[model samples]
Target: MHTVVIGGGVVGLSCALALAERGGDVTVCEAGTLGGGSTGRAAGGIRAQFSTPVNVDLSLASVPVWESFEERFGVDVDYRKNGYLFLAREEETAAAFEANVEMQTARGVDSRTLSPAEAREHCPQLRAEAFVAATYCPDDGVADPHSAVQGYSRAVEERGVDVRTRTPVTGLSPPESADGPWRVETPGETLSADYVVNAAGAWARRVGRLAGVELPIAPRRRQATVVEPETAMAESVPLTVDLDRGVYFRPEREGTALVGGHFADADPDVDPDDFSESPDLAWTAEAVERAADAAAYFGPETRVRNGWAGLYAVTPDHHAVVDEARPGFVVAAGFSGHGFQHAPATGECVAELCLDGAASHVDVSALSLERFESDEPGTVEQNVA
Candidate 1:
C-alpha cells in the first residue's frame, strides 16, 4: 500500500495498473507528458450507450478490458468494434430513444431500434431525413487514446510502477496520521505516499487545493474534428451520434473522419497550457444546420481540416470524485469527459479504493468527497461532455 498514482492519463495509467496488480508499490506521478490531459485529447469514444446505472455498469465492466487490449497490454489499442449510432432529432429525442432502448436492453446492452430505415444499416452515410430515431450499439467502439495510454503505460511499468514523467504534483497534504501517507508537493521534490490517487485530469480542482479539498473541478473545453473523407467512407464506420446536437462522427485512418462534440458546452480558461482548439465556428455553423438531414458530412462543401482542444474535468454533478479525502487522501479526478472510456472501470475502482476500503467495482459509494457537501450525488455522472 505504498501508492502514489497522480496522473499519467488513461485514468492515471488505469490507476497505476490497478495499484500494481493489487500488490501495491505503485508510483506513477506524471504532471506532464504521456498522453497528457484528458488522455491526450480523447475522442476515442468506446461506449455502452449509457444514461446511467453507473454508466451502464462502467460500460459493462469496461468491455472485457477493452477486449483484452492487445492480449493484455502488449499494445494495439486500435480496439474498434464498429458500432454505436444514437441519432434522434425529434419526438422528444425519439422518446428519449424509447427509454434509452429499454434501459440498454435491461443492462445487457447490445441495444437496437433504428428506423430512419435502420439507420441505413449502420450509416451508409446516414441523413435519413435527419434522424427520427437511431440507437444501434452492436458492441460500441473506438480506441487508441495513445494506444490506450501506450498500452497502459507499458503494462503498468512491468508491475513495479514508477512511471513518473516530469513529476509535477505540486501539493497534496494529509500526513501525520489521518491514516497516514501523503505529503507530496513537487517542483524540486518531496514525497510521502501511503496512498494518494487523484488522477488529476483537468487539474482536479487545482489538485484539490493542494489537499485542503475544494475540488468542485471545472475544465470543459472540448473540440475535435479530423475529417479527410472526400468520399470513400467505411473503415468499418460506427459512432455516428446526433443526439439532438452534441455532434459526432467516426472512422479515421486513411479515409479519415473524426468529428467533434457537436455542442452544449465549452467555456475554457483552466489553462494547463491551453490548447483552445478554437473551432466553434458558431458551433460549426450550428453543426451544419443540425447535421443536415442526418448528415453525409453535412455538405455545403464540408471542410474543417484540423481541430484540437480537450479538457472536461467538470463536477457539480457530472460525477467522478472517488472518495476518501482524508485517510491518505484519494479522489480519482472529475471524469466529466468520460475519462477515456472510464479506463477499465477506473482501474478496478481505484484499486478497490486503495485496497480494501471499498469498491465493488461500481458502487464507488456514489464517488465521494461527501457528494460536494451533502448535495448527495458524488460521482454524479449524468452522461457528460
Candidate 2:
C-alpha cells in the first residue's frame, strides 16, 4: 500500500515511520524544512497532567517512546524527566487540581496533589504564598523538539520512506469510490496513494479543504520568550505552570529559561501564512513579568535573550482530531499545542487506522471529527499551557 502523508512536521514524519515499519510505501511532503513549522518553536513539554482522559492516555502511550527515543531512533532527543508542576492560585482552580489529580492517578499517571509548601519544596523559587495548591507528576518532563523531529525524519527515510522537503501539497482528489486510490497534487509532480494523512500542523484546515473536507482546525499564534534569570535557577526545577495566570516556564540551559503561555486577549485565530514570526516585544514583556511572579529567581533584572512565535492548530474544543476525515483521507492535526508531545502515539494510532482499520494501541475514537457535531463536545482539557 502506498501512503502519502502531507506535512513533514513531527506527526507527519512519525506517521511515515510507522507506515514504513508496516511495510507500506510511504512518502512525507513538507512545505518547509522539517520541524520549521510549530514543531521547531514548541517548548517541548511531555506531560500526562491533562484533565481529559484522552489527552492523558496519549501522553501515557508516548512516554515509553520518549524515554527510549535515543535507542529507538538513534538520536539523543535530550529528553529530561525532571518533572511537571502545575500550580493553582484560586480556590476553585485548586479544587480542580485535586479532582484532576484523582483522575490522573486513577489512570496510572502517578500524579499527586501538593500543598503549597510541598510545591515550594519541588521548586523553591515559586511564590508559595501566591498559590493555593499544586499538582506534580514525576513522570512528566521535557525534550528537544527539533531533535525529535529530525530523528523521526531520519528514521523514516532510513526505512525507505521518501521525505520531500519544500514540497507543498497543492490539492487532493479523493476517490470516486471508497476503494479507489487518492490523487495528491504537488508543484513538481502528482502522486497517487492508497491513503493520505493530513498532518499539516497550522495549515491542516487548508489541506482538509483540498480534500473537500471542512475541518474545524484554525491557526492560533502563540508567543514564547527566553530569558537569563538574575539568579541561576536550579537544574532540578520542574517545568512549572502557573495555571491561574496561564504562564509556564522550563529550564532551557544552566541559567536561561523558556517562558510563555496563552494570552486570552491575543488573536484566537491567526492567518497562518501572514502572521508575525517574530515575537511581540510587549507580549514578551508581559510574559517575563508573569514568569517573575511565579518564580522569584526570574526577577526584574532578568534579561530577555530572545523570542519567537508559533502557531497552534486548534480545534473547537482545543483537542486533537485524529481520525479518518474521509475514505482515504486521514487526519492527524488540530492538536492545539499538544501535537509535539502526542505525535508518537498519534502516529501509531494513525497507522493502525489506515493499515488495520482500527486504533488498537490506544482507543482514540473519541478524537474523531464527528464529535464536534454532537450536542455535547465532551470535556475540555483544563491543563493547557
Candidate 3:
C-alpha cells in the first residue's frame, strides 16, 4: 500500500519512516525544509519520567532509540543521559510529585523521590529554599533535536521512503466511496494514497479542515533562551525543571545553559514558519530574572547568547492527539512539547494503525479525537507544560 504523510517535522518523519519500514511505499511532503518546525526549536529533553503509564512507556521506548540512533541510523543526536530534576516548592504540591514518582517507578522509569537536602546534594548550587522535594531520573536526558530529526529522515530516505521538501499539502479528499482511501493536493499537484497521516505538527487543525475533520489542535507559542552562564557547567544534570515555576535549564553548546518554559498570557497561534530566530529580549529578561532569583546557580552574570521560539500544537488537555481520526486518516500531531522525545513510539503506533488497524503494544485510545467531545481530562499530564 502507498501512504502519503504530510508535514516533515519529527513526528511526520517518524511516521513516514515507520510506514516505509512496514513495506509501504511512503511519501513525505513538507512545506519547508525538514525539521524546520518546533522539532528544531525544542530544548530536546528526553526522559522516561511521567505521571501516566502510557507516557512513561512512550518515553522509555523512545529513549533507547535516541541512545542507539548512532548505531541504528549511523548518527548521534548528542544523546546525553545527564538525568533530570523535578523540583517543587511546597508540601502541598509534593503530592503530585509523589504520584508521578510512583507511576514512573511502576513503569521502571528509575524515578526516586528526593528531600530538599538531597536535591541540593545533586546540584550544589541549587537553592534549597526554592523547593521542598524533587524527583530525579538518572535515565532521563537531552539530545540535539535537529540532529535527531535529520538522522531519522536520512535513515528512512535510504529505506526507499520518498521525502520531498518544500512540498505542502493544500487539501485532502477522502474517497467518495467507503472502499476508496484518500487523495491529497500539493503545489500544483495531487496524489492518491491508501493511507494519509496528518503529522502536520502545529498546523494539524488546518490540515483536518482540508479533510472535513475537526482537529482541536491549536498552535501555541513557546519560547526558550540560551544563556552563557558564568557558573561551571554540569556535565550530568539531565534536564532540571523548577516545577513550581515551570522553568527548566540544561547545558548548551559552549559553557552556557539553555533556559525557558513559562507560558505567556499572550500565547499566540502562529504559522510554524513564522518564528523569530533571535532571542526575544523581553521574554529572555523575564526568564533570566526569575531564574536567577530562584536558583543560586543562576545570576545576572549570564548573557543571553540566543533564543528560539516555536509553536506547540496544544490540545485542550495537553496530551498528544494520536489516533485514527477517521477511516484511512490518522492523526499523530499535537504532542504539545514532547514530539522529539516521543517520536519513535508514536511513529511505530502510527504504522500499526496502517497495518493491523490498531497497535498491539500500546492502547492509544486515550489520545483519540472523540475524547474531546466531552472536553474531559486528558490521558496524561506528566509531560505537558
lDDT of 3 by residue, 112-223 (tens): 9998788877677788777888889888888888888879888888989988899999989898897786988998689898889999999899898998899989888788
Error of 3 at 224 (Å): 1.1
Worst 10 residues of 3 by lDDT: 376-385
lDDT of 2 by residue, 1-385 (tens): 9999999889998899989999999989899899889999889999999988899999999999999999999999999998999998899998888889999999999999999899999898888989889999998999999999878987997899998999999989988776788999999999999999999989999999999999999899998988998878877889999988988988888778888897684466888889998899888988889888988988878999998999989887888999998888899998887899999999999999999998988889889999999998578776356
Clash counts for the predictions, in order: 7, 0, 2
Residue-level error in angstroms, candidate 2, position 147 = 0.9
Please estimate how well model 1 matches the true structure, expressed as its whole-model Cα lDDT.
0.76
lDDT of 1 by residue, 299-376 (tens): 666665776767778777776777777676788888776778887897888788778888887876766767677844
Ranking by TM-score: 2, 3, 1
Best by TM-score: 2
Which regions of candidate 1 fall more than 4 Å away from where they truly are? 1-3, 8-30, 33-36, 44-47, 50-55, 59-103, 108-111, 115-187, 196-295, 298-300, 309-338, 341-348, 355-358, 361-385
RMSD of each: 17.3, 1.1, 1.7
Model 3: how far residue 226 lies from native, Å: 1.0
Per-model TM-score on C-alpha atoms? 0.35, 0.98, 0.96
Worst 10 residues of 2 by lDDT: 376-385
